[model samples]
Target: MAVLRVSPAPVPAGRRQDRLSTARPPAKLQISAGAHAADPLLSLPDLPTPLKEKILCMEMMGIDSGRALSLNPALRSTPLDSLHVIISFLLTKGIHHKDLARIFGMCPAALTAEPRRDLAPVFNFLAAELAVPSAAFRRVINKCPRLLVCSVPDQLIPALVFLKRLGFKDMEGLAYHDPVLLASSVEKTLLPKLEFLEREVGEGKEMVVRCPALFTFSVENNLRPKLGYLVEEMGRDVAEVREFPQYFAFSLEKRIKPRHRAMEERGLRLSLPTMLKTTDHEFGLLLQTADSSPTVGP
Candidate 1:
């Protein structure tokens, strides 16, 4: 080939830069120097950087970001010493990391609570006064972390006293099954619910202890209607209801009424739980089988 020199394409006047400027690239996220300085987390020199970042990341990614942000001021106000104390004390109480994360995530305010004033008293009360076992204490606190922040004398003590007076002898059962009961209003919630249950099934505390779940059911909607059907309409005794207090949990329209009607029409006798717990198709099949069976004259 002929040694012909080929010229390169000309660069546009504005585009050519032989030497690049030694300047920092513009930041994708612009934050003021004052903001970095004023951050409360940064002000605490003792706080581990990883922990600080974890808290901030958790707040940003929380289910309710606005609520998390609103809570940040409270969190920032908490002394690092207090936060550490709370965490350490909880760990000592046998709470696992996953449970602690879940509890703190749900009630972030608990992290800001004073370990001595807010948390220690509750733990002491649960362990010493209520005699809640370590494992049971962890379970209760995990289920109702709000209990950590509740007033020991005013709220927790009163509720426990009320339940005790109500003959709740199984403290372990209360702790594991319905620790939220400890946080409930004695006058407003617990008393009212107990009164309703007593009115329906007589003043036997054993019934309540047998079915602690009775406290969780709705009095007006579920309990009353179902009790009315079973006791008033079906003529089942309070003793029967007391034996199977879970009957109050069934849906009056969907389960109780339909099943009771089918059983009554077929003259079939079945336990309350069996009748209500079975599916509609199962109930229908039960009715068909009962009808097909020959009746023996007694």
Candidate 2:
């Protein structure tokens, strides 16, 4: 039972008024060696009966518990600066920079760059105060969407790849919603066509495209049933005025919902869904899903 002694001096004139009344005088105590054997031993100043009792109650506990016991306004006689260390030390156990970033609506890469001498001590105190990893006791944090905000246009490709690595697979649709990043690249004419394709076809667990543009080319056996087709006899019809590509294709295995399935599956056996859809709307949503759900937990 090693004992610790705490001696608190009077708070300076300018600072003491902010956290506590300055009416209280400074304290000095000559504690017994027997009392010092306790984990937390306090030397007290001239104080009222109630205040003295509170300080005694805190000193009875060990150092870690003593700080907690002293949290009460009546028992906390430590100066404001000392209290700052105690608070920071105790708080460090519960929070880390990542958590702070989430709370502040910013990315971990965006923490303030200011230098600080006191910050190091506070950080060290916190580390010592909370040796346990906070992640062990808490659920994993959700990835923030704000990180995807990009000012540089070229970052779209790498950003998408990075997001995929981080388990955000269904992000193609978000490109339309976001003001930055890939969303900006989607032209007004092309965006809605993508969205209509998604809504009409039902995105990619099952996909099919059919058109008469490639009459003689041998269709892959695996993809034939998924094809959408228009009759060749209607070549001169207004619907066929739009030029068809050398081959009509469908992206068959996507993860988004509500659209982007095969034309055959959706009965959209049209000559030019792209041209027709594109003329009607400027921008559309393209949603792609991942093969598996995200992993989340502590």
Best by TM-score: 1
Our model 1 lands, by Cα RMSD against the true structure, at 12.2
Q: Each candidate's TM vs. the true structure?
A: 0.67, 0.15
Tens-place lDDT per residue, model 2, 1-298, is 2234556676767888763753554555534444432233333445544444434433332123243433333324443344334334423445443443242233211121111333333233223422313442112112222222232334444434433443444332233232132313333422333343345333311121122212222344312322332232222232232243322343333311113333223333333544234321221211111112122111
After TM-score superposition, the amount by which residue 218's alpha carbon in candidate 1 deviates from its true location, in angstroms, is: 2.3
TM-score of 2: 0.15
- Which lDDT tens digits does candidate 1 get at residues 15-129? 5453224433332422233233224533446866544544544443332434543765676445546656777888888887567657876777787777778888998888886
Error of 2 at 244 (Å): 20
In angstroms, give how far residue 135 of model 1 lies from its true place. 4.8
CA-lDDT, candidates in order = 0.70, 0.32
- RMSD to the hidden true structure, all candidates: 12.2, 22.6
- Provide the lowest-lDDT 10-residue window in model 1: 1-10
